[model samples]
Target chain A: MNFSSKILEDAVNEMSQLPGVGKRTALRFVLHLMRQPEQQTDQLSTALTRMRHDLKFCKKCHNVSDGDLCEICSSPKRDETIVCVVEDIRDVMAIENTSQYRGLYHVLGGKISPMDGIGPQDLKVRSLVERIKKDGVQEIIFALSPTIEGDTTNFYIFKQLEGIDIRTSTIARGIAVGDELEFADEVTLGRSIAQRVPYESSIKN
Target chain B: MNFSSKILEDAVNEMSQLPGVGKRTALRFVLHLMRQPEQQTDQLSTALTRMRHDLKFCKKCHNVSDGDLCEICSSPKRDETIVCVVEDIRDVMAIENTSQYRGLYHVLGGKISPMDGIGPQDLKVRSLVERIKKDGVQEIIFALSPTIEGDTTNFYIFKQLEGIDIRTSTIARGIAVGDELEFADEVTLGRSIAQRVPYESSIKN
Candidate 1:
């Protein structure tokens, strides 16, 4: 779309670069910003710039943090010996929201996808291995998604721990809680049946 | 949802302040930014800041611009005698995209909506009247929406143009091209029939 103003066009161009936002949505967002107080625009720009400039990555898990270690990695209450490996920080937040796991996390930053040119080396795989060996982690849980890339990443990490004494496992695949079985995909349903746990174990959660 | 990093939290809080963005979507956007190279974030932040800080409003039409006057208002190719008054810059763009109107535009910035506490005094209505008198505009077309608020704003402007020699008109309301007649609303269908023009006049377009 043609914009009358250069600055308005520039703002929309930048906004449309986001994942799901298109030109029209960007225009709407820019117009909304224009309607608000100039201070609101300043706040938004300051917050985004500050976040980008001042943000740090956790040395241990590669998650975003204010300092050397993220809250989950530094918390004494979290299980340091049992680490849950995830694709990114969003997975860390999702698992944290569940409040079911007490283990620390290893954020790979991305899955090992050959199509995207992201190999095991591109991720935080080396750091995770070094962490397990240095920290003497007892068990490593693969909490990655059920995609082929997730399986490949899990296998890659499993191979890396070949000589190590640490035990490795993946999260159980099953139908989501409160979901209808009839609507579940065949692969998931079959996997749920194959990995059926004891009634007491399932009910406990 | 809780954020592990303070910078992430601040960015998400500011992003979610946009019209349609929620906390979850804001978090998703923030995380997406975090995953990209630092330069991408810098570009986005820089563009937004520059747009907000350096943007100018057109002196005549109140539309966004880089200089004192907007592109349409400053262009000699545009018809200075006929002006289309719209509710906002988006409306001006939508009308311009049609390429049917050769006249300049006057952006009201907003419509008269009592429910939203917006009135005639809050818009650029005075400047529109001043332009018509000073520039000797022959015709004024209302390109606002067919909403009650749009009608209220139109009537308010019409009252201001009393005793003026300029001819006033509104955009026609009818079934959209390629739209099924059966799907058309009763009010729109009735208005279209009541304001029916000669077949020759309609076919000329």
Candidate 2:
């Protein structure tokens, strides 16, 4: 779109660089910023810049942190021996929100997607393996998404741990809670049936 | 959502202030920025801050401009006597893209919506009237949205120009060019039928 001011155009172009944001949406965002008080724009810019420059990744899990280690890694109560391997920090946050998992997380940064030119090396896989070895992690949970890339990354990491004496497992794949059985995808349904837990065990959980 | 880092949380919170962006989307944006090079974040922050701080509105038309007068108002090719009044700079850009209207534009910044606590006094109504009187503008075209607020704004401006000898008209309200007749709303269809043009004039245009 034709912008009347060069400054406005530059702002819109920069904003549109964001994932999923289009030029029109960026323009709307810029206009919204213009309508708001100057302090709002200043605050937004300062926060983003500060976050980018000052934020540190947890050395243990690769999750965003204020220091070398994330809150989960620094906490004494969390089960450090059982590390949940996931694609990114978002997944860590998602599991944390559930309040079901007390174990620590190892953010993979990304999965092995050959199509996107992202391999095991591009992710935090090496760091995770080193962490497992150094920390004497007993159980490694493959909590990545049930996609081809997710499976590839999980298998790659699992292969790397061939000689390590650790219990390896994947998160359960089944019909989501409150979802109808018929709505579950075929692969998930089939897997759920194949890995059916005993009635007593299910009830106990 | 539970954020591990305070800097990340602040960035997400500030980004979420943009229209239609929620906490989840904000987190995505923040994460995407984090993945990019530091230069990308710096450019985005700088562009937005500079735009908000340095952008200027045209003295003549109120459209965003680098100088005192907008390009449209300053152009010698544009007809100074006929002005198309619009809600904002976006409307100005939309009309300019059409390339059919050679007249100048007068931006009202917003419509008269009592529900939103916006009135004629809150808009550039007075400045528009003063402009028409001072510039000897012979015609005023209302190119606002076909909404109650738009119509009220138009009527308010019309009342302000009571004694002025200026011709007034509104942009046509009809079925969109590529829209099916069956899908056209009743109000637009009725107005199109009531304000039917001569067959010769319609075909000529």
Best by TM-score: 2
Q: Write the per-residue lDDT of candidate 2 for residues A10-99, one digit (tens) a residue.
A: 999999999999998999999999999999999999999999999999988989999999999999999888999998899999999989
Candidate 2 TM-score to native:
0.96
TM-score of each: 0.95, 0.96
TM-score of chain B of 2: 0.95
- State the displacement of the C-alpha of residue B70, model 2, in Å, after optimal TM-score superposition: 1.4
What do the candidate models score in CA lDDT, each in turn? 0.91, 0.93
Give model 1's share of reference contacts.
0.74
Report the error of model 2 at residue A159, Å.
1.6
Report the lDDT tens digits of candidate 1 across residue range A114-163: 99999988999999999999997999999999999999999999999999
Docking class of 2: high
| lDDT by residue (tens digit), candidate 1, B1-205 | 7578988899999999988999989988887887688888888887888887788899998888999999999999999999999998998888888889889899998999989999899999999999999999999999999999999999999999999999999999998899999999999999999999999998887
Regions more than 4 Å wrong, model 1: none
Candidate DockQ scores, in order: 0.74, 0.89
DockQ of candidate model 1: 0.74
